[model samples]
Target: MMKNRRFSIFIVIILCMVSFSDLKAQAPANDKASVKTFVQHFYDWYNVLQADDDFTRKHHLSPFAFAIKERGNYFDKPLRQAISDYFHKPLKSGETGLDFDPIAAAQDTRSGFQTGNVKQVGNTFRINLHDLPKGKSEKEILAAETFLVVVAVKVGKDWKLANFIYPAKGNMSQTDLIKLLAHQKKFGY
Candidate 1:
């Protein structure tokens, strides 16, 4: 009963959310320098995925990786499954799972960081994200979305997801709703 146009848009939106997730993940490097490094590293990882990343490489995520998702049920997995499932393929060690074009990706990254927040609490790192609603009231409700994450300590100088929660509508998955889409060719729905 659903049209392909709707299906395509759904897929695009999910992928964009996954990309945003990547852009937002970080462990917070001690000081301002460390914070910048942490954010830049994650940015690079996202860039690779945007590029030709055929398989997903392992990530040293913060301990509070999915804290927001867990508390709010926005996502159930350690990270967003929409992103994880797409990169389920195996990748060579030391290779980037995702890569982005340097020039354009840099510009986008710069703009994105201009409006974001990252905080640390002992071993866990928390994140809060908000964006302008676009040509409207500055005092009015802006993006009005926030997230809380609690990251865990990893091996020396590293960290991975411990728990995270994100307030999300948790939209019905397009992958499950649609039938006969190329991705579901095997089931032949």
Candidate 2:
């Protein structure tokens, strides 16, 4: 009888371990879904405003900058502070603040931007934003060029925008929004 009891306890322990492992696997999948949903919602709302020239001009807004300023709550603390510091920092003679929209990495937008792949490493998620082919979705754009990458960090059970990563091109190395802001002295913003 004691042998049977010990065997039952061992089975229960094994079952518990299996159950926990399954739950652990599922947690990451749920987090990925949550990140994707959040990014998609942000881009959908942002793209509409980006395409509206009249609204932007009337409100004296650069679309992405306006979004960052007005919706500051959506960003992670460090990135938001970096942007605020950059914006408020006085420009030296012949120096310029950021001229292009860092989110889209362009001065003009065509309303074709869409959230592509979302990958998470630890607490950080790298989400690719791609420009869809004319009249076609990004899925149809065979190797669609990445416009920019949005970095989001998990914060208190939610995801918040951390930075925008522009991929390397030509002689320039890959750089992120915070780095760009901090390097104003070197790159002139």
> Candidate 1, after superposition: displacement of residue 57 in Å?
16
List residue ranges in candidate 1 displaced over 4 A: 1-36, 50-115, 129-154, 168-189
On the 0 to 100 scale, the lDDT of residue 80 in model 1 is 42
lDDT score of residue 183 within candidate 2? 84
For residues 22-120, write the lDDT of model 2, one tens digit per residue. Answer: 665444667777887787788777877778878677878778768987788889999889888777777888876887888777788755676778887
Q: Which pairs of residues have clashing backbones in candidate 2? A: none
Reference-based lDDT, each prediction:
0.37, 0.79
| Residues 1-189, model 1: lDDT tens digits | 469889999999999999888665544455434443453344344334334333223433321232222332323244445334434545555655334222122212222211135566654454433322223343332345432222333435644333333334368322221121223223321
Give me the candidate number with maximum TM-score. Answer: 2
TM-score of each: 0.29, 0.77
Q: Report RMSD for candidate 2.
A: 6.5
Runs with alpha carbons beyond 4 Å of true place in candidate 2: 1-27, 133-138, 185-189
